[model samples]
Target: MRKTIWKSMILSTLAVGSFAFPVPASAAVQVNPVPGLRQDFIKGADVSMLPEMEKNGAVFYDVDGTKMDELQIMKNHGVNWIRVRIWNDPKYGVLGGGGYTDEQRALELAKRAKAIGLKVLVDLHYSDGWADPGQQYTPHAWKNDSPQKLEQDVYDFTRKIVQDFRQQGTLPDMMQIGNEVKNGMLWPVGKLPAKDGGKAFFRLMASGLKAVRDLDPDHKIKLMIHLPDGGDNDVYRKFFDMLVKDNGVNDFDVIGFSYYPFWHGSLQDLQKNLDDVSARYGKEVVVAETAYGFTTDNYDQEKNHYGPAEARRSGFTATVQGQASGLRGVMSDLAAVPDGRGLGLFYWEPDWYAVPGAGWKAGSGNNWENLSMFDQNGKALDSWDVFRDVSDETAPVVPVTVTEMDEPEAEGSTGIPVKLPQSVLVTFSDEHQEMLPIVWKDSAPVYDKDGDYSVSGSVEKIDAPISCDVTIKPKANLLQNGDFESLSLDGWTVTGDKWTAQPTSGKGDAKGEGSLHYWGGTPYQFTMSQEVMGLTPGKYTVQVSAQGKEDSSKFCLFLIGDNGEKKTAEISTTGWNQWRTVKIADVEIKNGKAVVGVDMKGAPDKWGSVDNFKLYRQEDSKAAK
Candidate 1:
């Protein structure tokens, strides 16, 4: 899911205050030539928030530190097309900021893009807010319209928008009928699984198609039917069959798909689906949206959508080179499509890097900064070279030698076999590294005694064996960062008003310099939670060393069992720095995970500090057998 904030271009010069901008560290990726690649292959990016970012004091810099417009940098790095999304009356709501992507903003962006000799693709969301597979809410103004009225509204609205763009000489090169309509658009009436066997959905889609075709009978602008999950073959085959074979609505020229490997299936699945669908339907295919995180670090208060978990799933490391590798992988897959059916791909929101005032909505922070093509400093990432390099696609790079290997790490109780990472990072001769699959006779380490151990394995490409060193010394503390030594809430999710990390003086068995601290001048409630995943079925104990103001403030250490059972231990404090141990024992771990947290509630001047939050397994547990 994409989270973005936009502002009016007129207000781009407004001051939004200062923010920390880190300098670019990695060198630009080296471009390689891919033989037989189409000369007109699309290298696109959706930088709809360019103006909004600029309004919030964002400045774009080229690789060489030359401050410039983001679009110019994109063009310089081989970006040939840009995608801009337009929402119907999104002045207020989730995108509310008086600067949402209305028709005016989209047109302005389109005109600027065209002026730069870059093609523009218009994405019509058909909703005031986000319209994706999970959401397709009817616009507020069209909420009360009948099915017949709604269809006509869609037709008229679409025609008028196209007419405006055409009159301004900024006609889109391509247009998406509706954003990610796999589940249908303009919900309820046109929602999927209709009683009329998808007739409503098809009719709604056909109306939009007819509107665009009516304006441009010569088909100067190609229209596309967009869908999510490009890797799912069954979804594509079934969807297109219903739309074309059964419903006879095939006026669209391109089949657009959104493929995010972390959310969708693997790269192979994407290639298979794209190859099959293009041949089966005989239409051009384009990856409408795709992005990968260059880092797992959170640049703002909002939690990053693509974290370490997503990185591991994407089979790539969270690094600049990994980002380039991912883009190359997608580009290579698209290029391999039989019969040149693959049109190209558009990187989603590549310019929406972190800016203090620019967030998904008001008061929120950026959750997608890690996935942006630019770094926190607004400097272009080396991955931008993928657009330039893919043109010269030569033979694939191979791992000649293992330059580096990331050691695997895991924590579990003694005598239990803990599952280690299946893939390990291996930097190869190509200068880029990937989390390639590894094999070993003893993949899962069974430690009879608690300590640290090294496990060796063979990586897929490297001739030499790679080894991993892990500490069995959790002392059975399943809760990571229990001592808060990281000085950050690395493993915990803090919700409610501003719980912070404060330094501790080794108070009452707290080993780290940091402790989870919370202070509120007014009444408030907060939860600092850590979800420990992949636990063996057994009984466990949750414990924490805590201190607080000796008052009526309610602070409790709690645990939600895997099956949703809850247990809590009320924490009592005598005075500041007078720490006491709070424990909740006999918590059953029926599922493979447990949620442990500290929930606080109180009035003005209430304060608390917690450290050494740990979960311990019972000796006579069922999993121990």
Candidate 2:
């Protein structure tokens, strides 16, 4: 079932979503044999998003009973609980940031959650900023401390935070000691794996968990030890085995899983992992954090994006319909896990939609709006309310007990179509193709003409999520020998402040394709002084693109200031890949070199290939000056 997809480099064609859009076959006639099914049920979304609702004037529980709010709408749709993440003193990054869950906001939202009769689960990430597998920098105040001090801080913070919530009458129904702590957290002193310098990882975890117990004492709290997205059995196995041995394993209650279908493996893998976890650890499982973007385009260019599916999924389709349907399927599968052991799952922050000031990364804002449950304007999306069992606003709830079926089969009475799922198998014939010609699609990632090989998407470049394939295969077709295929923009330089464009690995950036035309040193380098010309008195911006194996290097888009001073806009190219676009901005003037490109690192090397250069002048006069 090969479908026609538009493939291109991008200027601006982003929508929030999960996978490549499976070319819709006009008829429902089968193209291939569908795989086994997951007859799972759903519990609903995390009600923690209600605070955003209140802040937005969208009522969760109307004191005066004014009108139906998203919370009521959610409950009516079958959502039973709201999960809130509690961070310690996250005034700057977590608490004050828009859209992200902060402590104060969490309390506000928790009150709304309780008011709505929604069970609340308090997730505590010891750090004030985002905590995940990749990087878990310690909290600022705790940074300059000994391992013992850090340990006490972790315990005290968890204890006091939980105690405060309890005192406020909004104690979380359950509490997660730390957020996705696979690699361990609160660095420098309490880091996990005890690697680098933080030699007290396990002890650090103990300190925190102990604190939770100290505060509660009753042991009623359902403690959770969350790891990264589920589906990676090897990673989890290693992590769990280490925890059991080093941390003694009894510190937590529930096994927290964060499953994102696109990044993680298939539902089959997920089920297998869950069963394995429950069987191996003898603990209950809860999908602590889970979500799927309604679209792939960045709704707000100023903030955060989950990295659109197009930029990540070139092997299978990452579409809104697919993600939603996948969510339904995931829920259903979890329901069927042994012993109702699959308790429930929470849709991570379904209320995080588009808002004027909501963003994640600094400088760029609102780039992830399309990926949120809401649009850029903060309005809810139809997709946001989607639930397999109780999506319909007018749908009647089938009682948990039925006279005929014995158990609760009330959901069967409803006509909610079972979201048919297509299992993506890594088969021989359909081996993940690296050929861009076969892989590219008609999307933001595929920024060019539909089904055509696009050289560059646009000149006035804005950051867009990039999606492509890997260059693992050793073989290539003619032209020149190379091992990788990379995203290259046209007018952009090979190296600049924003990125370090690298050479194809003696081959194209992507596999199956020959050595790319402008990939390596053979691909001419667009140097400074020769690239930029016009300038004005206002600020101007030019986004730089970089890709490939060679990551570290210096590059910049330079401009001569009115004082004849040489100023350059440098974007951090610390972590460059073929799948993202970085922006560059600096003041410009009517002079020489308004936008110049230069490789600051004098050492000769193939950094990366940059193309689709975009120039945005603050004032229109700058464009003409």
Candidate 3:
């Protein structure tokens, strides 16, 4: 599930909207034949909100306004699998405000999915609400249990849940023991870096695994261990190494990941991580949750979570064509996994249209409306054709070429520009009336002097080799240890009550080993600053990644003058689990000296951290004598 700080907050009243319910279709109605992809590959979606939507009188309509069964529509469009999340004893009833994912609802949905000949994957959140990397609150009933007791509880709860599903003839085809267990599940007890070197965490997870194995004696269900951010290779390496190699608790059959292109890295990063993990662990990899926007337009009153700007950053246009293209690229990457370990992908909540009472929370209608395969009006989009039309055999092939451009003088050069190929050609095995468009980037390479260097790039929307080799020189970063890659605060000074150099708990700077954490206990303030001094004065650009635990906490990145005057840019701590970059442009560095750092003022219950500090002198600035 997507992480949000306000996930548990509830609205006092539900929004009012009109709904038209159509006559229920018979469960035995025959559907179209299953659309085959690569051999045994899974094309799936998570329709956890379907039950709630139906209960609220929401209805699905085809493009012609004909009412249709949601599951049958998905099966006709090539989706063979369905995922449902289960929450343990939610505060709200099964269809209540905050917790709609209770066991009974999940089982009901699972049975309905199975009735449509679709496989089911059960996601065990083990919490009343969302359980992600940011917050993994233990279920209220198990909050006070001892570690040993908690382990037993996990086993007992999992066994009972599986047994219940079996008795109902709706056992999940695949099961996720935990949802996004990147930082460990169930909070402090089962969380990472435990007092005994994560032994307790592994033991807790082991109990859950044992329950799944014992319950499914015939090995009918495949088990999965899920983590967030499928693009982070280091995280996968660190996490699985501890769980499998070091601890010897490798019982899961599949490795599941959540890959949201905007939050995670680029497609290249996703491919690399998937390849590495599949080869190293020899486990089938599945993108358990992924989605792309087809439009930035807000059709409903509720705010659309992804806008045009974010969709563009993801290298795909916020249009139907772009969504289709994005899925094609993703499928291509997954198909390329070594030894065919790539099982497939599941579009997260693609049916979450902007219907009445179908929103993630009360009063707010479908924040992910733009990402749904169906438009806000409940009409299927062109993106749905991606599943029916594009297959491994008929996939579009895109070929790219990169050629070097003549290098100019290196004097005062900040970035080197490379010429792009005149045109990238796309071809398909069968003839097509139109050509598929492509999205690509030609990044400016850093050139310090006139020498040989290498630069990388990527192309999206088709299956193709996206990398090319270019020659250039490299430029030097003025601030030493700017990214904290050295694992020490060698060139930084702390002027406050509390600061520590440590590996960040959540997603840190895109590339780094450590970050400066400021624990300014209640009502305190601290600053971690680094000064770069020399002769040659000019304009510089300062950029840093900083975040805080709470909204009240303040985190600011500043450029300090020699006389102590500071030019600061405030950083928003809204998405504490995600990193946001703060850039101070055109900062004048008179006397060739300035202090660049982050200042954090701690709130009563919050702290802040900063990392990936970078200072670059503008090449266009006048040179100092």
Scored by TM-score, the top model is 1
Summing lDDT over every window of 10 consecutive residues in candidate 1, give the lowest-scoring window.
14-23
Candidate 3: 10-residue stretch with minimal lDDT: 14-23
- Residue-level lDDT of model 1, residues 1-625, one tens digit each, is 1111122212112111110011133334543455456899999999777777888899999888899989999999999999998889885446554237788989999999999999999998888867887678889889999988889989988999999999999998999999988778888898886789899889889999999999899999999999987888988998899999999999989999999877676787898999999999999999999998898887778766676546655655677777877777777787888989888999999999889877777677887999998888999887798788767545233222334565555566765556555665554323343456788668666776767777777764544465666667444677656776533455578776432223233333244556766665446788889887667677788899887778887888899987787788898878677888888888778667889998888666776678888887875344445
Q: Using lDDT as the measure, what is the rank order of every candidate, best first?
A: 1, 3, 2
Q: Total backbone clashes of model 3?
A: 2
Candidate ranking under TM-score, highest first, comes to 1, 3, 2
> What number of clashing residue pairs does each candidate have, in the order they appear?
6, 74, 2
Query: In candidate 2, which residue ranges exceed 4 Å CA deviation?
Result: 1-68, 92-95, 98-101, 195-199, 302-320, 361-364, 376-625
Off by over 4 Å in 3: 1-37, 92-95, 392-554, 560-625
> Against the true structure, what is each candidate's TM-score?
0.70, 0.58, 0.66
Q: What digit string (tens of lDDT, one per residue) describes model 3 on residues 142-251?
A: 99999999999899999998999999999899999899987788877988656777888888889999999997778899999999878889889999999999899898
Of candidates 2 and 1, the better by TM-score: 1
Pairs of residues at least 3 apart in sequence or in different chains that clash in candidate 3: 448-474, 453-472
* TM-score, candidate number 3: 0.66
Tell me the lDDT of model 2 at 421: 9
In terms of lDDT, which candidate is stronger, 2 or 3? 3
> For candidate 1, what is the lDDT?
0.76
